[model samples]
Target: MINGISIYEILTLTTILFFIGVYGFFTRKNLITILMSIELILNASAINFVIINTYLYPENLQGAIFSVFIIAVAAAETALAVAIIINLYKMITSVEVKGTELMKY
Candidate 1:
């Protein structure tokens, strides 16, 4: 129910969400949290793309298609991340930050 809110407001909100995601990705130490933050950033970009396309070019559906692709990619990314996290947890029994440092050469 945002009355009189212009397209700029929507873009601003998207930018804020994107920055929040960037902050979370930078600040979080846990792997899962980082992955979630990445997803958030992706979602923010997708939303902004869709909104811009819908408002500026109402005839084209390319933005919607791109958003769908983003969703699919996000789903695949989450699945892979979960699998990796589970394997890491099984190996160490703890999914804490710096747990994978041992893998570094």
Candidate 2:
């Protein structure tokens, strides 16, 4: 174990979580599920960023600040996306991935 936590262990865990998010994003057809997957991916990224920052610059707190901002933005995005999805569902009676594609035009 390095630094009381093996580097390999941390990397492996992060990789697994990232791939799980990717799989969810690709396999899930519902808009909400896709949103959740996106959130998962964002979380994984934040985790990796924090770990790297802590390892490389233990004295600086910039990474924590950035992570907080990321969380705020992700929360806002999820709120807005959920509202839009609800509206779309009300109009189409469904929240499937392709159901809202017509809104593009």
For all predicted structures, in order, the TM-scores are 0.90, 0.83
RMSD of 1: 2.0
Candidate 2 lDDT over residue span 27-59, tens digit each: 998999999999988888777767766776778
Q: Identify the candidate with maximal lDDT.
A: 1
Candidate 1 has its poorest 10 consecutive residues by lDDT at 1-10
Residue 60 lDDT in model 2? 84
lDDT of 1 at 25: 90
Q: Which residue pairs collide, candidate 2? A: none
Count backbone overlaps in model 2. 0
**How far does residue 17 in candidate 1 sit from its true spot (Å)?**
0.9
Off by over 4 Å in 2: 1-3, 101-105
Please give the lDDT score at residue 84 for candidate 2: 96
